[model samples]
Target: MTTVSILPISDANGERIYRAIAPDKQSTGRTAGEALDALTAQLEGDEFNALLLI
Candidate 1:
């Protein structure tokens, strides 16, 4: 199964940033939801085995 980790962060402008971490892969978004969407899309188009948000 593929495992991913989510991390919340802020940019220089203080905008909400969401980061997704996976083996040899990473994705970012302006919001938590967006980040998850992006990360999932990158991982396997919503067919991921599992997702872990932190």
Candidate 2:
């Protein structure tokens, strides 16, 4: 399984955001779940397959 890192951050205006970082990609969302979902989508299909071969 691939490992991802989720970090909570604040914008210049102090709005909360979540950032999800994978091996070679990153995504952000309003919440942690949203961030993870975005990252998952990015990792699906060809990208996911490539990771498995590594």
State TM-scores per candidate: 0.69, 0.74
Candidate 1 weakest lDDT stretch, 10 residues? 44-53
Q: Assess the local accuracy of residue 9 in candidate 1 as a C-alpha lDDT between 0 and 100.
A: 86
Clashes of each: 0, 0
Taking the tens digit of each residue's C-alpha lDDT, what string does model 2 give over 1-54? 566788899977899998888888988999888988788898867554333110
Best by TM-score: 2
Q: After superposition, how far is residue 4 of candidate 1 from its true place, in Å?
A: 1.2
**Candidate 2: Cα lDDT at 6:** 85
Candidate 1, 1-54: lDDT as tens digits: 667788888878987788988776788987767776787777755558765757
Candidate 1 Cα misplacement greater than 4 A, ranges: 45-47
| Residue 5 of model 2, lDDT score | 82
RMSD of each: 2.3, 5.2
